[model samples]
Target: MSYVLNDPAAFADESTDGFVAAHRSLVRRVPGGVARTTAVPEGHVAVVIGGGSGHYPAFGGLVGAGLADAAVLGNVFASPSAQQIYTVAKAVATEAGVLLSYGNYAGDVLNFDQAEQRLIAEGIPTRTVRVTDDIYSASSDERQKRRGIAGDLAVFRAAAWAAEQGLDLDAVAAVAARANERTRSMGVAFSGCTLPGATEPLFTVPEGQMAVGMGIHGEPGIGVQPLPTAKQLGELFVEALLAELPDGVTSVDGARLAVILNGLGSVKAEELFVIYATVSTELERAGATIVDPEVGEYATSFEMAGVSLTLLWLDDELESAWTAPAYAPAYRKGAVATGDTELLTDDDAAAETETIAAAATPEAAEAGRTARDVIVAIRDMIDREADELGRLDSIAGDGDHGIGMKRGTVAAARAAEAAADAGAGAGTVLALAGDAWADKAGGTSGALWGLALRAAGDVIGDTEAPSAHTVAEAVEAARAGIQNFGKAVVGDKTLVDSLVPFSDGLTARANEGAALAVAWAGAADDATRAAAATADLLPRMGRARPHMEKSLGTPDPGAISLALAMHAAASVLNHTTAQKEES
Candidate 1:
């Protein structure tokens, strides 16, 4: 169950090689094996950035037409050497001079300082900007010591634009400094990340708890706190940033900001958006005008389950630069129409009615009802066993799978009930369930559940009265679709270990002319058996495998939950059919 590369040294080299190979056209290797890009427009202030390898798009992904001119990549969580930085600076600097912008960590500062000295000796003008924007990192004395998080993007963009405008070295440095001053970022981690091929995580957090102000490279956080809802988390982050704002600004009246909601690694866009919506609304209420809002995986730490919020106070110049069109591999902007009153007021009721009507089929409706009931039962079972499942996953995983599964299942059930009460049919119910999972669940399980429900709805199609065979076919199609998307094989000790067997058993029985009741029951039984058998095997996928022996004898909670769901479906189908016959 260990990772494919256990050692950080090797993993870092392999990853950097792959990155350079993939972007060969846009990047070139300099004297110190540092990669440099010339995509930035000439005479634009050349911004050279660098950091460890694992934080994709941070040091490299932003290198392109509108962003960084060059980036020096280092080993995992380690800063590149001075020679590397100097080489990249030499390669990318234009007549306006180069701006060296990076996080304020000791390693980065030490290395970049050396590079600056070297660049000066070689007659190349250079300026340095160190990002120290994490409010939780330290108090006044320690403020300079805090590590940078996701605010590097804002600093880089502002400094680069200033440089592009042919600002002097001091002015460029001031722009970067001001951007850093206005920027404050904070992050929370639900789970730790594994170095490539590592058997264990670099750090660990307790289940149902989050580590606030956790560093990107597994540094200890300011404190551990109970996991908050996305809305609550957003409020807390916004409050923290607002509290730390310079006295004159953010006093409930004078704050104008650009907000960046960034995913650490594994957090999905849907979940990130929820946080963004909450933060944006809260800021608006606080009298802050959001000049720019960037949401995505702009910075990451190899599948870490966490997110960060970075706020930058906006001046007129900074505002213009922030909104200025810039193209990068990961960030971009296009012309957007302003204040389209007609489009905003267009009739949406008719479209909404058509959409709902299209999804209201009898067979789909019945399937949705069954799914709702099954999800409720599954949620109950998970709640009862949540602690035990957490203990099991804790040994080889982050231990949140149990809690995540319970939350996702319960959310799905509630959504289904709400949709049904609203007189929505199966497709609408399933869509609601998917959205709930996407909202409440923050990791791999949530994504899978969301995908599964959506695929099931798609398979049911437009039919109002699908036969039993159609139902079975839809189930099979869902199983296949999940398998295709996830790429988990039967023996991987993944949910597929149970689901594949169940799908096959059901298909066999259905094809043999067995009653739907008998077929579903058999399928549920087989799934349960297969899930139990997974205890004897080791997991080879997801975050669990890193714990090695931890999961050897414990069934994957996902697999067990899937079996429970099938059994619940069997009960619902049998009861419904008997009542129909009697009537």
Candidate 2:
């Protein structure tokens, strides 16, 4: 468990603040995360790597000379929002373009791809290479679906080195992809990790047993077995990696490899050295030469009692990039030549904030106030149900959905209130609330909800008060946007499970000439029932897919949260109807 914190919810933010302060000479605070304090050569391809926080050196710590130009940090165990990634990229990107790299998780892929599209649309040449190197997550035929673990380090380093060598955007991206293909990793957990403010670990390993093939996001392993000795563990890692070489590697007998024995948080340096000794011995015995081997905490999962081993089978070009001199806060190799650093101005560090436009009509202003009230109610409802949602998520997924929802709704409520107070229209209020939710929460749920709200806002413009038919149209638009963005269908056991039924129900009721409040109530009930029904479905996507059996009897946290939000919105509608009747 993480022992120290100001507020559990604010732990990630606060820790980032401290890290920037401590490494001011190396990095500067950017809106989304951190950027290199020292300037890179102008028009050089900037390598931007990131993922969820809690995996320290992987992201922020890697921002410096010969490494990542910027890192877009998210809340613990959650991928950063698309807005966050865009902001970070814009800060560091030059005329040469940018290379974005991160682990191959569902949320990271979604957010990063969105950011990549936005950058290209804005005339910034941006490319991406998602690291997929965890051998245990998927078979060789399905390697693209594998989760990224410590192999993130190898890919990030290679891409950054390519950029440092004055390579163009395409070359940097290609190098990153090559590094990812050559890298292979496997991890084991003695016990699961616990998030801040959580009462217990996300999942627990039985005493004297080790969970094999666990993910850094607190996902349980594919199987469990008795804990092995350090030597035996080293043998297991070497054997697995040697058995399946990368496509070009004909044999491991004389292969040159870049090795990383990474400690996942609580594991000590001494223990790692002991394992590395055995690892080195085994590799040499197998006639493979290890070069520039790193043994320490490079990437971590808060305080997980686990470790991972990564082997990057190196070609001539790869060897040059892998062995280059580098300097980052947490990772350092040979001495890096120093030069005068550039200090960013206030405007460079500050992200652009949205401006509130005036309402088009007084009726629209009143509707904005109603929207604010609805968001506030939803926030309150989420606050009450957060723990239960977390419990359900922890059964098979990383237990952060509850906290992510809370953060998003709180930010949304505040933004909506501010917009309404500024005399903005309902459309503007919803759009602003969506931005706040996505920016503050930074995860899959946050991005989807933000997209849904913004899509609805686009349909319900500021020109007039929305009629029941217009409201139904807005709901349909929101549903369409979520399905398009997340690519999750009704039976995927995602929030779409509930959202689809709710949208269809509302559209049906409104088409029948029902009142807005009456239609919303029916839709809310449909959503609730649909969410409950998800307990019987197996997960087909995201982190939960690997442990689908464990989640058999539990409803998806995303589906349940969407249902709760709908019910809360329905309550607001009911109250407004009651007030109108009394008047």
Best prediction by lDDT: 2
Tell me each candidate's TM-score: 0.56, 0.98
Q: Give residue 204's error in model 1 in angstroms.
A: 0.5
Q: In candidate 2, which residue ranges exceed 4 Å CA deviation? A: 345-347
Q: How much is the lDDT of residue 533 in candidate 1? A: 91
lDDT of each: 0.71, 0.90
**lDDT by residue (tens digit), candidate 1, 208-251:** 99988777865545578999999999999889888886534636
Model 2, span 284-358: residue lDDT tens: 998899999999998899899998999999998899989998899998889898866576732576778778997
Minimal lDDT window, size 10, model 2: 340-349
Worst 10 residues of 1 by lDDT: 343-352
